[model samples]
Target: MTIGSLLLGSTAALIAVSDARAVTTVAEPDPTEYAKICDVYGSGYVYISGTETCLRIGGYLSYYVGLGDVGLFYHARTSDVRTGEDQGTWQNNTRFTLKAWTGQETELGTLKTYTETRVNFGNRHTSVSDSSRSYAFNGDSILTFAWIQLGGLRVGKDWSAFDMFIGGAGDVLNQTPVPYGALDTNVVQYYFDAGNGFSAVVSLEEGSGVVGTIDNYAPQIVGGLKYTHGWGAITGVAGYDSNYESVAAKVRVDINVTNELLLFGMFGYGSNGKLNDDPMNAIDAHGRGFYKIWGGNWAFWAGAAYELNETTSLNLQLSGDQLKNYGVAANVAYALLPDFTVTAELDYDRYGGSAVGKVKASEVNWTNANKKSSVGGILRFERSF
Candidate 1:
């Protein structure tokens, strides 16, 4: 072949090879992934990557300052000095709470799990003589709630169904002066929703305290039925104390008076009257049962909430029992920001009947002929996310 023809042939072969190489150069797929927002349960949920489950994390921080006779109203031990002496002092507390939730869809129903943890730091009064410090630094931490649910069945630590059914209405501090029922225990529970705002719950609980705790296979039984609508709801719960062989029942009604107003009332009764003389005497033979911790055979609570504006609201509560223990609590809460709130509250308590006589003669000297009432107030600020 001629030299020019050889050069042309070589160049043509090189061009053909370059074309083949270009055709074979395939691009790789992208590997970056982003989290997806989950709207199934509520806000702040996101789907976990490479999984079918959705996860949510949330928390809140709060600081509280209390004034007036807080010790008297909150049942703090007083100084063993002169009669009718005020045992009030300034108090401060800080708390942080963390919560997590996870959910997934299953053939039977939605499977879910929830957890809540809390830590508290406070300058609590250990004794009347030990009140000269500012920050005690002694704090406490607890796993307040941890539970799992599949369809309608749930198992874990939770509030008793007797108290859960007829929940506290207002945001008033110290709502349980008369004591409706005990809270916080391990439970195996099942819930049923009949649709149209009708639901029911049955729970077997490990009662609180040594004597109240289940010694045998017989656990504390709690059952409740609720009817709810756009306006409000009515709920009733009954609890059977296996150890004491007694029963207690509570009925509550909530009314939506207006778009900005709400009202609620609850009444509780116990079968055994002899057991209620001492609210915390659970170890004694005729002790108050786990379900009936009120200082009487019957108790009642009423509360109201009124929204003053979009960012402000007022709440009030009145509670009493047949033993003449009465309490009044009120609070005004204002939202300083989208997820921040400030609240101011006032509380008053009165001791009557045998409790008053005991207070008058006790070493603490909390009450006298003219001093049967105690008043206190608190200011709190909280930020939630």
Candidate 2:
């Protein structure tokens, strides 16, 4: 036999021997170490099997009280209702997650399958509904992630590998993500690690908008590259749509100024020029950047965003000509003790230019059609288990 055939035969023999040994070495149960059972299958399971399996569970909870202004206005260009007020109340956020992995050895190689689910409790009942508590129920907050990995190939429902930056710390805080109308979508992505802190990814995701052209739920392809080091990380992406020949570019950068401070920013542009199919001939540009300072138990952040120019006339008709949205925020916390702590935050938002489009000066509520140029504060008390 050739050398290659000999090697394969020897490997198969070794595996057969190993499996036989494992079966013969199965030990008897020990009464001394008998523990309560958590068996999902079979008669009982005192302990988990050592078959290359893994599990992890983690998440957090948050309760907040906010006092702010919710105002209203008119649609007429001549009307003004900028200064209005509304009521305030308390809100709660509770989330939990569970994840597990199963491992199996196949002819090709070792493979792993994993799935995770997240539950956002209070998300089911929000006071923002126009009617009763039933009306308040919105959003399918339950998120699921599943994937299989064999060698370099991985498929799953997870964060688009093309994402530039994560909003907030992936937490439930008033302004953890600095939301000023941002986009975050799920996708099926493939990633190739280039070693060192650089990597590249390509993904196929559900087109977020502009339906009927691509059969509604058609796939959009996106690709991006990212690099990271001890001090910072940067990412960039380009996306394409087959229907209208559109392309979008997005970029984000995060810098660690010190052990306690962070600086970050993001920018994106979308256009339909590449395909020679400029149906709406649309273009969009938006940018946001912030600097955060941290102390022993206190932190402060200040940032601003500007939408330079928009080709979408609908946006212009609603908000105004020069759309500038900016905000400044700060937070302070005291450990109080190991398991308990108290925190507070303050923020202010300012909207100018054509940014007044959908906002009704007379409606003092916080919605897509209302603009807020006011200040607000939040307080929270937390306990750990």
Candidate 3:
């Protein structure tokens, strides 16, 4: 063979050998490999991620069914219809909620915000039949909770600092946790963290009582301090309500001896600060307190409160007047099974006084004395996931 042909033949053989080796070393990829990758690291409906914001979705749902009798009114004459009737009914208060939270990491710091909405499918009995009928008092869908937490400031509607005096998550029964008078308030607030589970908060809220309408824009100042530790928690609150010029104060303490045992109690007092002859004069104040214990599948709570009786004010003829206010409540609960429970509660109230103020100042009027109370019990079965 010629020299040029010999060189060309060897080059062609080398090219063929390289092509065969490359085909044998490489295998075909599986069609399902891409799907597996997506399942392990791809986005999901419950999660979102982008930029510096990480979001997580979570909330709680509760359904409550109850039957009981509650007092509605009191007759003028003690001998005539002094006590109301025992009305029996069923109720279902269910709620479902959604919450979204977003936080961004920046040079200054991490800024965060959250918003929530809830639908209170109030007791089915409150709804009319297929033929549509609207009930005004039947609670409709609501913006149950919405707030923003940035640095040390929180703005928007939220739980009042004073409301902690009533009860904590330890209470299994919902309605019996707080009295009508000692309720939560929606307001704008600012708080300072003292570290070591201690914090102080001050808030501007509406007046003390619901006079005739709902307007939270009224002027009121509330402040409180809270401290938490492995052994226990304690809180104190003080406030001023300008409508009645009311001065209010409260304190609460809770102790956890073990994982299952707990002891808690709270005391509260409020008084109208204005003089009787003053232009904005309003006289009303009261004191309330309660103690509770729970452990080993059993819970018991008892409460006693008194308010200044305003029954003897100027117009005594039309308004049944007296002086002496009293209230009491007791509750007990036991677990029947892992998922079932039984609860019983007794509540009582006696309204008296020419003016309801601090409990110590209320007077006793023998002629207009009256008593109102009720006994309620329920069995509940709950399944949690």
Candidate 4:
């Protein structure tokens, strides 16, 4: 073979080798991260990327229509309340609540954080300057809960332990027809779960708005103890109102008669004499405190919940205060789907004390206060995720 032919053959061999190398090489796929289910806590939780923490986001949409003397529409109008000029009509409220929960395992225990935000639109409690515009957008708080917990220690905005510990007068739509206790406040609380069936909680709280809030640096104190078993539970709660310098306590007992029936009773006592001193409480004369919200110095509440079936339940509450004020509330809750429920409730209240607000200066009544019997009801629909 000639030298040129030999050189061409070598070039062809080199080209073939280069093409073979190109065909064998492949670019590695870009690194990817996938969401992982974190079932350690429960369903709907996923581990955060690059972290051991688990997060779950959820909320609920609730709609309720109020009728008769319901709390949603019975209050006298701020503009013309003295002459009893009020807007007593059908009222509706729609709320969208968003919630988030984060949890992680730590040496101290479970580190957790929770937040709840709410938005409302409907015929809330507002004076109608333009009679035609009764419905509007309204909300009490955008952020109802923002709390953090390390083990049993929790700090942030939460409902009072006094009301939460005892389950709050059954599952009634109108929890406070006779005013069991205050609901909202900021808290620094600690919980202790004794082995077996005993647990306890102590809380230092900053009371909520106007009449309930603490004026000085001294915080309100509340404590509770509970014992639970298969049959039922016995729970007790007590609170010291720093502002009013009074103490209120409640003791409750629950009995699980059968697999489907549960009965409970609670008794409340408070040094409500201070109520007559404050102008705000003077209107009601029951000495309303953050912890003691009953009509008088003593009160009793009895309630029961019976599971009629898998999808239906019946709940009822009967409450009375020392002043002879009595309330009865009953409701039937039916679950339409996994996360949706509808409840209809009826409430009857017989006012024991005069509703007339007495002015220290004159006998003028501030609100259209009167001792009268009233009937109210609510139809509620809620969907939670």
Name the candidate that leads on TM-score.
4
Which lDDT values do the candidates have, in the order given? 0.79, 0.45, 0.45, 0.81
Q: Cα lDDT of model 1 overall? A: 0.79
lDDT comparison, 1 vs 4, better candidate? 4
Q: Which of 2 and 3 is ahead in lDDT?
A: 3
Count of residue pairs whose backbone atoms collide, per candidate: 0, 21, 18, 2
Q: Give the lDDT of residue 258 in candidate 1.
A: 98
Off by over 4 Å in 1: 1-34, 71-87, 127-135, 273-287, 353-371
Q: Give the TM-score of candidate 2.
A: 0.55
TM-score, prediction 4:
0.82
Q: Report the C-alpha lDDT of model 4 over 154-272, residue by residue, as the tens digit.
A: 99999889888777888888867677787789999999999899999999999887768889999999999999999999999999988878899999999999999999999998875
Alpha carbon lDDT of residue 136, candidate 4? 52
Clashes of 4: 2
Per-candidate TM vs. native?
0.81, 0.55, 0.58, 0.82
RMSD of each: 6.8, 16.7, 13.6, 6.1
Q: How displaced is residue 323 in candidate 3, in Å?
A: 8.9
lDDT of 2 at 74: 6
After superposition, the stretches of candidate 3 with alpha carbons farther than 4 Å from their true spots are 1-47, 70-87, 122-138, 164-170, 174-186, 206-218, 274-362, 366-370, 379-385
Please write out the lDDT profile of model 1 over residues 142-222, one tens digit for every residue. 877899999999999888888876686457877766677878889999999999899999999998777678878999999
